[model samples]
Target: MSNSARVESPLEHADFAGLAALKINGGVILREAKLLGHLNLRGNANDPDFLKGVKSALDLDLPLAPCSSAQNANTTIMWLSPDEWLVIVDGVTEAAIEGKLRQSLRGHFAVSDISGAQTMLEISGKDCLQLLQKSIGYDLHLDSFPINKVIGTALAKSSAHIRRTGEYNFQLIIRRSFADYIWLWLQQSSKEYGLSVTL
Candidate 1:
């Protein structure tokens, strides 16, 4: 009976249903709880050579400087620290992407694959800013945290990779282990406005 059994996971489409409880407490929210293929790129943001390599690899310029982001349709490059950034994408195309970056940027830079290490939680709606104000310290003003800004900021008792996905849609990319706590915090925060959680 135990010859070579290949078992598939029962959890097919991420945490879509469990988010209902959180959703019921606030405005509509969508959680793209996928193992978002993520990579951390670190180097001199002003280095013209590095930028050239990055442009060649991803077909887009790297988001140099703090609180910046550059995107193509699928890949989003976000600035983390002054010298670090996070590259995010969907689907099962991680190895190819990582390999390309590694091959392209052959210098004093780091390319780390963090796919299994983090999870993405998208919190959007009319109450997105209000909900975020309760958590982070950085000014979430329209002029400050403008559209397409990617910030590595705080989220309640945890850290998150946050980005403005739309006018009202903000995405929170967090670590895997801290998810449960973040989920609880989100539920508590969105209680004032009726939340509709979807995955």
Candidate 2:
């Protein structure tokens, strides 16, 4: 592929940029973190060398605790399982980051560039929790689901890896094939509180 080739997000047809221009104030705000790189990493969590290599490659410690996440200015790493993680970074940086991991790490480690397989959506505003409540069965209480926590669960009959970023903010990593369905679900579910789209 040429450098000049156009890159399109899974929700490219949704035209979120156009909707963002309307500037409608709603209780729920949504934004697509379009074309960000998604990488699925698998390795031994018990191995100190693996952890050290990951930290060296990404500049952030791998979140080893269950349903936890770690983030810095450049990347966010979510623990998917005892031995699996999902790393999100700027779209242009995945290749370089993956290369660093491959070069620095050794022994039974795997890194797959799954960027094209998923997309991320940021949901916030006062009614964001309510919107989420209508979709997922997971307890949304902060006490139960603290900030910087990640959970893979069913959302509106589909599935997503949901991460709480703040009191009223969440980041969802969803499958590309389900993007349109989730988009429509959000539209209908947030109709009562109103929905605002941001670029």
Candidate 3:
């Protein structure tokens, strides 16, 4: 099978061409990021066999509550909507991992490769939450926004699935075409913090 069959991402756009909403060095700039293949998994948590199967295969606990996560060395599982989860794997492991999951699952369940559905933007800094609140509607205060929480909310006049990757770092998951728009928004918001575009 071609590389596209097992895993793929929409970052194939012309270099630094899709980012228009950003200004770096007084011009549009691009910051390259590392993304493993993205996967959307749907299943009910009430099923022990199904849950146990996932744990056995991934070595990561299934997050049973909303806005929660379970992590292993290289994988982080985030709750995405009810009865659904998002799995992130380093490098290219979508295809083989998808198959392994299919074999491990039974009963009502569905999994789809969404590596192409969204591109990742890693926006992080000491003042990342300040910038995040400027871009998103969710309350970014530490009292409200704790670590390891996932939220699908509007960001910078666009919709994105945002996840907190660290205390001051976050991963914004947005559609392919909006890459430039969101990237632009980040720089614009970060300007107050003396923005520095690295790659």
Q: Please give each candidate's TM-score.
A: 0.85, 0.97, 0.82
Candidate 1 overall lDDT versus native: 0.77
Residues 1-199 of candidate 2 have per-residue lDDT tens digits of 6779788999999999899999989999999999998999999999999999999999899999999999999899999999999999999999999999999899999999999999999999999999999999999999999999999999999999999999999999999999999999999999999899998
Q: Which window of ten consecutive residues has the lowest lDDT sum in model 3?
A: 21-30
Ranking by lDDT, best first? 2, 1, 3
Please report how far candidate 1 places residue 82 from its true position, in Å.
2.6
- Looking at candidate 2, the ten consecutive residues that score lowest on lDDT are 1-10
Kindly list the per-residue Cα lDDT of model 3 for residues 1-199, writing each as its tens digit: 5666443345544344333334444222224454577788889888999898888767788888888887888787988877999888765788888888899999899989887767877666666767777777888866676778888888877898777766777777788778767766776777777554554
lDDT of each: 0.77, 0.96, 0.73
Best by TM-score: 2
| Model 1 stretches with alpha carbons more than 4 Å out | 1-15, 18-26
lDDT for 151 (candidate 3) = 87
Better of 2 and 3 by TM-score: 2
